[model samples]
Target: MCQEQKGFTLWFTGLPCSGKSAVADRVAEILRSRNLKVERLDGDIVRKSLCRDLGFSREHRNENIRRVTFVAKLLTRNGVAVLTSFISPYREIRDEARREIGEFIEVYVKCPLEVCMARDVKGMYQKAIKGEIKEFTGISDPYEEPLQPELVLETDKETLEESAQKVINCLKKLGYLDHNF
Candidate 1:
């Protein structure tokens, strides 16, 4: 039987279309390939299920983060790596998540707003600009960038593989994974 391994939460935060979800998905794939139990809490998908009643208000956003953090903490303690992809616009909520989830790695996926707008497949950014979406982060609302994230991935400059490899390297460096990676 394989020895049990410690689990950690890899939190990805950024603006809409900033590559947080894409990078998190790639990271999950790599970790799963290495035989790690992984759970991905994507904001869009989770909001539909876990937070169906939640809205875009600050309180709701924090509540969403809290819910995700709670699950992440549970999974981490049970040896399941959790990758959370949320805009998580507020620094306080992100810090709260870090405190609640002991083993947390905050990855700031950096991309210019213009680049993000251009990459917006959902047209949410355009709608936000037109006042169709209220409390929309980065356009109608605010996105407080992480002050001291564990890792910063300039998704605009790096390929998906490079960003994912960086996260994998960080996990190995922090002893979350075997050094052979």
Candidate 2:
């Protein structure tokens, strides 16, 4: 008999260059390898398309996440695994997303600001620090840490594989994935 897979949203939130995208990508690969349907909604890619008209201000940022949340909700309820990687710096907005998407799993990609800045190849942190980029999370703006995230991956300390495995383990424990996977 064929087993039906349930869908869930893996929401990865963190500061810039904190390995949110990388870990989410790895998890998506693992999920897909298990023959699960997966869709990845990343900040950079979405901003170039769905959120191109948006800016970095707080209002724009919230609107950007609202739009993503809407898409995720639809995908999740339709039995498609959705992985999203965005800074999503506000706790209220993340909570709102959780409410909107029933199967939301918030993964706090916890990395030190200094470490994230060090990992910045695009010099986004540098630009933000120099006031060239305003309203940048962890620099000019703020990133409110999750009060009770479903998972926390400290990219500053954990290897990519380890962090990805943690997410997989969480999904299995939460019954989002088959334990055999």
Best-performing candidate as measured by lDDT: 2
Against the true structure, candidate 2 reaches a TM-score of 0.98
Per-residue lDDT of model 1, residues 134-180, tens digit only: 99888888999999999999989999999999999998888888899
List pairs with backbone clashes in candidate 2: none
Instruction: Evaluate residue 20 in candidate 1 and report its C-alpha lDDT on the 0 to 100 scale.
Output: 94
lDDT of 2 at 100: 99
Point out where model 2 deviates above 4 Å. Answer: none
List the global CA lDDT of all models.
0.93, 0.94
Q: Candidate 1: lDDT of 43?
A: 92
Candidate 2 global Cα RMSD: 0.8
lDDT of 2 at 15: 91
Write one digit per residue (lDDT tens) for candidate 2, span 19-117. Answer: 999999999999888889999999999999999999999999999999999999999998999999999999999999999999999999999989999
